[model samples]
Target: MTGIGAKALQTRWFVRSPIPLFRAGLGFVFGGRLLLLQHLGRTSGQPRYVALETVERPATDRIIIASGFGAKAQWYRNLQADPHCRVWIGFDRNRAAIARTLTREESAAVLSRYRREHPKAYAQLASVIEEATELSIDDIPYVELHLS
Candidate 1:
């Protein structure tokens, strides 16, 4: 599959650009669709931030996000080392939270619902993820962030 290389994904200016907005407490501009995840780096133990699309908001305090780059993603790896983190969602900034990797069954269910509700987005995301990781959407890693 034709996919973006690691460098292309990491160096994309636009991907990291919104981070400033979230840091500036203007994250609400993205509505509830995207969130800024502030997690501790696995090696450095320093704060790292990444903006990710919300695959599902199952509850007021729970959100689902996927790792399109598979387990190799730095953010996903950091969350694995330390699940504790913070979230900046619409109108909410720097809220304490915890991250959890979903089981295969849980990921399947969430992706199913996401596909149903957001067919267009799911189609595009699935394509990019599949191309990048050479894995089916169901095989991608999904993380649930629970706010405190």
Candidate 2:
């Protein structure tokens, strides 16, 4: 259950079960915020995908996503290994986009603006982050996907 703490839920069967449906459903889940990032595995060199939330959309060709699980998340690491990737943005996907991890300052500014735009969701996310990691949302890292 959600109240079971972050670690337990992460390893539980129920948590993993939705992932398959998530991948299968792709962009249908959370409007355009949830996207299936298609990237390469760092060592295996195989294609991989992980659903991520689009926290900020400053421009039509650019989108920002936070590392909800921190910098050690597999998808974040994969992007560092290979900047080139595609985002399955529902109807029109952004292919061969450049994924750049934003600086701390940039992330802070982005989150500030994001909070104003999505006040209630931001508060909920902050609470979840605090519960999961015992840290503020500011501790997490973010990335900018520059589409071509």
Candidate 3:
């Protein structure tokens, strides 16, 4: 694992509480530039919470990739099996969302936008994506939350 990856994992387990507050603060300050709160599958059908970077496409009515640490994470795999989920943006509680796997063309366009908008994250991920060889502008699953 890269240093950043190891650090992030360490922080996730070690620095738990303050991180949520910090993420919420970032959401407020940046306005949609914060972490995504996703639910994961557990043994008893309960959910696990994970914070990830989220991209929203207002024009397309979609929330883009989580791409957690470059899409190799367990959360990504969980969503693949079950598409229904809850998303918490900012101070919101568990809001319902539907996960959708984008078409190759759709994924390419969305990923392109992501690279353009979040260059730093893009840079951090570019090498991982390339190394995975499974990475493509296409086939990156994106989730679309249903707005009430």
lDDT of 1 by residue, 25-125 (tens): 99999998889999999999999999988999999999999998789889999999999999999999999999999999999999899889989877877
* Candidate 3: tens digits of C-alpha lDDT, residues 1-148: 4455445544657524434664454444434554455556733456766665566556323466545344556666677677678765655545677777666676677778878888887766664444443454244556555533
Steric clash pairs (candidate 1): none
TM-score of each: 0.91, 0.82, 0.64
For residue 45, model 2's alpha carbon misses the true position, in angstroms, by 1.0
Ranked by lDDT, the better of candidates 1 and 3 is 1
Q: What is the lDDT, from 0 to 100, of the residue 47 in candidate 3?
A: 71
| C-alpha lDDT (0 to 100) for residue 27 of candidate 3 | 42
- Tens-place lDDT per residue, model 2, 10-81, is 564743443464556555556776676778999998988776668988887898998877877888999999
Regions more than 4 Å wrong, model 1:
1-10
Q: Residue 122: error of model 1 in Å?
A: 1.4
Ranking by lDDT: 1, 2, 3
Candidate 1 colliding pairs, count: 0
